[model samples]
Target: MQKPHSINLSFLAFIGVLYSFQSILGAITFQGMPAVFRQSGIPPIQIGFIYLLMLPWIFKFIWAAPLETWRQKKGRRTNWLFLVVNSVAIVMLLLLTLTTPDVGLYFIFILLAIIAILSATVDTALDGFAIKESNALDKNWVNVMQIGGGYLGSIVGGSLFLLLVGRYNWKFAVYAMVVLLLMMLCYVLFQQQSVKELGQKSAKQSLQKTFASKQVQYGIFIVVIAQLGLRLAQGMTMPFFIDYGITLTQLGVIGSIGGATASLIAVFLTGLWVTKKGPGFVLISLLAVQISMYFAFYYFSEKAELTLLQASFLLLSNSACVAASFVALYNLLMRLTSPEQAGVDFSLLQGVDTAIALIAGVISGALVQYLGYQSYFLLCALASFSALVALPLLNKSSSPLKVVI
Candidate 1:
């Protein structure tokens, strides 16, 4: 038996920075690319198909087990993988700067899919690294770091990048991202591996053990349903705003400043509530609030013309609800993980969540085309409500499995 290393801020902060850089990569594909396409008159259905490039995330679990074995033999390779993939990602960005969607749409998507593969690999490694380093108490803070860092990254990658695109041109925006990527690469190269590395073993037995449990099955359903509506609605938001006459710069300011600020506040408050009342309670409450916010957005969109201030407020509210929802659900997932099998269990859970979200995202464009925005939003509200039906599954008598680090 061995004592686990205590949690350290430097390690936690490193994870946060990694998450931020990853979000920047994601923003290039999801945020920056979509905004460009929409402005170029690409249809919503076509824009929806762009999400298909993200399919690698849904399938990363296929490699996660083997990667676990490799990790054991290699020792901590977070920096190695991070540096390699980001190096390739930077090359892709440079090539992307030369081609426009109008000129090379399919080629751009092909490159994006490749980038997604590398990014997903980095994501899998990072999640394992975070879980292996943190104990039960620190896991919540880890979740905060994950979400808060993503918000910060979204501000930089999503909003700020959009501003650069608006202010100058797409090439300039891509050039800007390349510079940021280089800075991150330098940081990753210089940073020492600060946490103790866990020995890798085949996750097959852990997989069998996890799937055999009724509680684990129930937890899987909870994560899928909990995340479904948010993913679906989020897929449609940029198009929704564009159709509503919102300018890209306005969206950038709202998202970078207002959304990021609000989400950080929400994460902090949710952290407090989770400490006081527990994750199960916080999860259900956040889901209820999420559902309400969807309806609220629907009402506002239909009933009146929204001024910039009103729109900003609505976007902030949306960001806050999303932040709270992520914190709550991840908190729940962290509790379900067994320390010995953290990699496989978390990957399987996340992979399934991404799979469900992929289905929802692919269909969301058609759903909106068929139903219109108001009805589409109501549909999201209804989908979120379905999660409440699964609440009984989480009500098992004993406490959640404690993580022994």
Candidate 2:
């Protein structure tokens, strides 16, 4: 893999902005619109199917191979990024600005799905660009940009967008997004691409052979095990808050102040730790924090009456740990990626992680319904603890990280 001679701040900024733009679409699809739909008297089942719009993200790896092949040409990824942002994403946002939620509900869904496809494609290309440009010493910093930018975008797309809708109108909020997207696109178009080419011999390897490696299998295991508990616990948080008597306005405030802000700080800190101590060490350490937070959550669930302060504390602290853990996990995955097929390898791992989160989310509702929040949280803690036991297995590999376990 070719390494840049120095840590380029401009490149990092570009990455951060790119990821933030992509995540805005994700935030709107997954978080922002659902609440709006529910408020607009859309049935629960109909809103539930909104998740199906995100299927593109999970299945994106299937197309990633072709994207990797196309990326063999110089500047193709950048060109593709520009094309998709303009033709699909920007156009979709513009269309959305013309219609209200009640009248254009189905139309908005279709537009969001198209935007999701565009976002997933852009993600695959950008992941490859980031992995190919940075060396082992700096991959964590790259992840800091990717994950941190995502949190910042979520705050805008999920929280600020809702605030705009509540105060102004849906069209106005979407127009603001369109303006932001265009500004980001201007940056993309002006920035010079610096990606170096990989060797054709390495690039020619079959996708099956790529997955057959023991390291890849271990990485997949790590992704699934590491994310399952986090997803399970997080999925039930809003419902738990509601059952405990937290109002919608309070939930929004807590989610904005606690979740996204905490995550951004955690992502930066986790990157530094991963850079210095290595991902293996960071992973184990963050998992310990995660497990502790899960127990704290259980204790809170048992409280006779939960206060806003307590809820904010639990949500913010857990969000920080989850963000930190994600940084560590992605750093490890980046280490495992092949320079020749970074997009394909990374996309498959991401797809698995997303799938695990989705399944865990589905299971979480049922588990909480049957067992209650306290027991469900206990199960989540146990699940995270299991990942700690599995850590040693993942550490027994040829990756650059020390076998800290």
Global lDDT scores for all candidate models = 0.75, 0.74
Clashing pairs in 2: none
> Model 2, residue 333: displacement in angstroms?
0.5
User: What TM-score does each of the candidates earn?
Assistant: 0.91, 0.85
Model 2's alpha-carbon lDDT is 0.74
After superposing candidate 1 on the true structure, give the runs of residues whose Cα lies further than 4 Å from its correct spot.
1-6, 193-210, 213-215, 303-305, 396-405
* Model 2 alpha-carbon drift over 4 Å, by segment: 1-5, 38-48, 97-107, 166-169, 192-202, 239-250, 302-306, 368-372, 393-405
Per-residue lDDT of candidate 2, residues 1-405 (tens digit) = 435445667777877888888878887776677667666666444655666665777888888877767665655556555455555788887888767777789899889888888888888878877777665325667778888887778777876676666666788878888888788777876664543333342354256856776566667878888888887776666556656766556656776766787888889888888879888788888888889998998988887768989978886887788778878888888888777677788888888887876676656666776778899999999989998887766457565333432
TM-score of 1: 0.91
lDDT string for model 1 (189-307, tens) is: 76655544544443442457656755466568777777887888887777677677777788888888888888899988887787777777787777788789889878866843566
- Which pairs clash inside model 1? none
Question: Residue 2: error of model 2 in Å?
Answer: 10
How many residue pairs of model 2 clash at the backbone?
A: 0
lDDT, residue 60, candidate 2 = 84
Give each prediction's root-mean-square deviation over alpha carbons. Answer: 3.0, 3.5
